[model samples]
Target: MEAYNFETAIKPFFWVASDKTFSVCLNAGTYKPEIFEWRKDEGFEGNGYDWASLAKVFLEEKRPDLAEDIRFDPEADMFCAYSENPDKLKEFITGFKETCENELQIQDLFLKAEID
Candidate 1:
């Protein structure tokens, strides 16, 4: 069996959107995007999972105050980032975190089952 690196496995989809600049860098983790100046500087952290899901996670993590209105279009690159209710967004963020942790646990369970 071949072992895959965690960071290397999910490096194909990571990007960043700044106020004045928008950039998309493919597999930013495996390849250096800093030299290209695609807004993926050294400080840019690659999404730890698949693209869209990671984007959502990143947004929620960075701004736990606005998670509800952060609807990412599956067919679009931009997120529908807006919300009139901060309280709802806060709730969504908390739920999203719990969902992520649950997913991690599930994955771990599956891996352990396979190993056993």
Candidate 2:
């Protein structure tokens, strides 16, 4: 079995709400075998949710295997996905961004801690 060290791996870019109530991290954009995580910001008290639906739909349609790894914690308002293939992850991320911008009508989001 192999182990992954995310901190040492390529850093992720985050998409966060304007109010900083929630965030989605696109871990290791093109870096192979990475993970994506989404969570509600600490101290947030709004009812806003569904941060993972678009990504989940994309994954389910394109990479069912990876979708199987999708995990959600409603209590924590978090979700995550682990993929061994970098290309596939990138595809999903692209779609996710587009969905967020167009379909979800979330325009206040922006990339955080982007890597060069």
Highest TM-score against the true fold, candidate: 2
Model 1 vs truth, CA RMSD:
15.0
What digit string (tens of lDDT, one per residue) describes model 2 on residues 1-65? 86864332323434333342333354322321112233224322211123344345555554576
Model 2: colliding residue pairs: none
Per-residue lDDT tens digits of candidate 1, residues 6-47?
334323333345664333334323432222233234322333
Candidate-wise lDDT, in order: 0.37, 0.37
lDDT of 2 at 116: 13
| Model 1 regions lying over 4 Å from their true place | 1-51, 54-68, 72-82, 104-116
In model 2, what is the error at residue 102, expressed in angstroms?
Answer: 0.4
